[model samples]
Target: MSRLVACLVLLALPALAAEPAPRRPVHTYSIVARDPVTGELGVAVQSHWFSVGATVPWAEAGVGAVATQSFVDPSYGRLGLEMMRAGRSAQESLAGLLAADGAPGVRQVAMVDAQGRVAAHTGDRCIVAAGHVVGEGFSVQANMMERDTVWPAMAKAFREAKGDLAERMLAALEAAEAQGGDIRGRQSAALVVVSAKSTGRPWVDRRFDLRVDDHAQPLVELRRLLTLQRAYNAMNEGDLALERKDTDGALAAYGAAEKLVPDNAEMVFWHAISLVGVGRVDEAVPLLQRTYKADPRWRELVLRLPRAGLLPDDPKLLARLTGAKAVKK
Candidate 1:
């Protein structure tokens, strides 16, 4: 092996031998689940630790999801997904990791495979009020919590919640907080949802990946980010429709995005630009006026688009949109 490869292998030996590895008391609540309807796999977590999102959750598009916390060995999240990708079931993967751990009693972990198989572990040595629940296609776990009811509340909320995988997992996190979350109070949170199947494109496979590194109300901040992400997702769809010359689809998508964030100048400006592109000058005028009213910079942006081919070079159309005469070159 190369020198670097040798060093990496040697470093990983401790984990293989079940030796005690350095870990943090990540004591937190989390969920791992597969959406039956969308085949999407996801993991969501919230903790009092700074940037808990970076350590606790792991997932693969066509394999499974893992959440490792409570004196967390991040190896569980990494190796667990590896095993699942290699064809092991979620339960088998969790069992193998637990068996190899020198200090399993201090760990809290959960997994949900792509096939909807579920497994979870709560170490007996975990802080008080620690526990987990394994439901159909999902698992919820928590440690160092203010109340033992947290995990149960999460399970209940997830089962009854409406919307996609991201929405449901978010509900679980919110429910945990409602039942008195981390005894130390919340600091950071993360949510990740991957497509049911791989498109051979990692970027395309991740439908939602959001994090609130440190916040007084991490879950609330996380939700706002989710909404913003949705609006951007709509904008992307509109762009794609424009490329395909599908005017109706483009309009619908831009309209959806505008409705989601009506106050967003960027989305409004783009929607107006799109309307003008489809020869709907009258329809574009009001949207352009609205955006120009919100920010004069948008009007300046219009004067530059013609040169970039984003808008036609027609002086009459430009004057109508900007309510100003175009200077002759």
Candidate 2:
């Protein structure tokens, strides 16, 4: 009977052994930074994963920015921000996250607090070429990259780049790509920047929140989106100037926006309309003519403006806008 029991136990040994756990590799790279001069915080990321930014990036006005990737537990983003907001330093917040997490070896996360303090953690079990580079006011982290040089390249580029926080952060991303980004290739990207002071309004405090949910060349698309965002921001400022009755300010802002994106037909059309709305019909006439010359659809929209109440009901103004000059009183 003893021999039979021993044989039975030997048979069950294979079944009792634990299986290897699964790996959830985010396989992404990112930067979390704070502008020393402005105190603004920013986070940017690119990954083969769908809507990578929606999970990997998090930031709060006057608190800190966090990027959590590689078997991403979005809870790290929320909890990290909560701890930072509650006065924890970047390192402390990271430690808290690691302590609470059951599987710390598969995670890669970075954080930068409002004071420019930076901290990062790259799990031991993260994919090859996975690590982080802590910088003066930022941290660059990557996992499952094509080479181990990606994070270092990002650090060098970010430190050398001459510009504002956003520009520098973007430079870091460009550098990462130049060094060979993800092992799987690029899919989605995102960027978010917040002001140093909390305005008590989420929208007001958020300076930029741009994302490319799905794209073939996500980094290039991301850069283009950033440029477009700047031009649109100028347009918004111009609109606000118009609201305050600062006509010169409005025109200057609008012209700045147009200059940023000279070929944007919609921008030119709106500027012309705003010009007419301000009783500067003479100034608007030439711009409207130029836009209609380039895009006949602008003229169609102009013709519909009267019925839509977007433009005055004056036929003279309508005629000039449409280049017909049919003045009917």
Q: What do the candidate models score in CA lDDT, each in turn?
A: 0.88, 0.85
> What is the lDDT, from 0 to 100, of the residue 193 in candidate 2?
94
- In candidate 2, position 232 carries an lDDT of 89
TM-score of each: 0.92, 0.86
Candidate 1 lDDT, 1-329, residue by residue in tens: 33433444344557666745457999999999999988999999999999988889998899999999999888888878877787778887787777667788999989999999999999999998999999999999999999999999999999999999999999999999999999999999999999999889998898889999999999999999999889999999998887787867888899889999888987888888888888898999899999889888898899898887778888888889998866442
In terms of TM-score, the best-performing candidate is 1
Q: Give the winner by lDDT.
A: 1
Cα lDDT, model 1, residue 8: 41
Worst window of 10 by summed lDDT in candidate 2: 12-21
lDDT of 2 by residue, 233-320 (tens): 8888887876676767777778888888888886787788778877888888888878878978888788776675556889877887
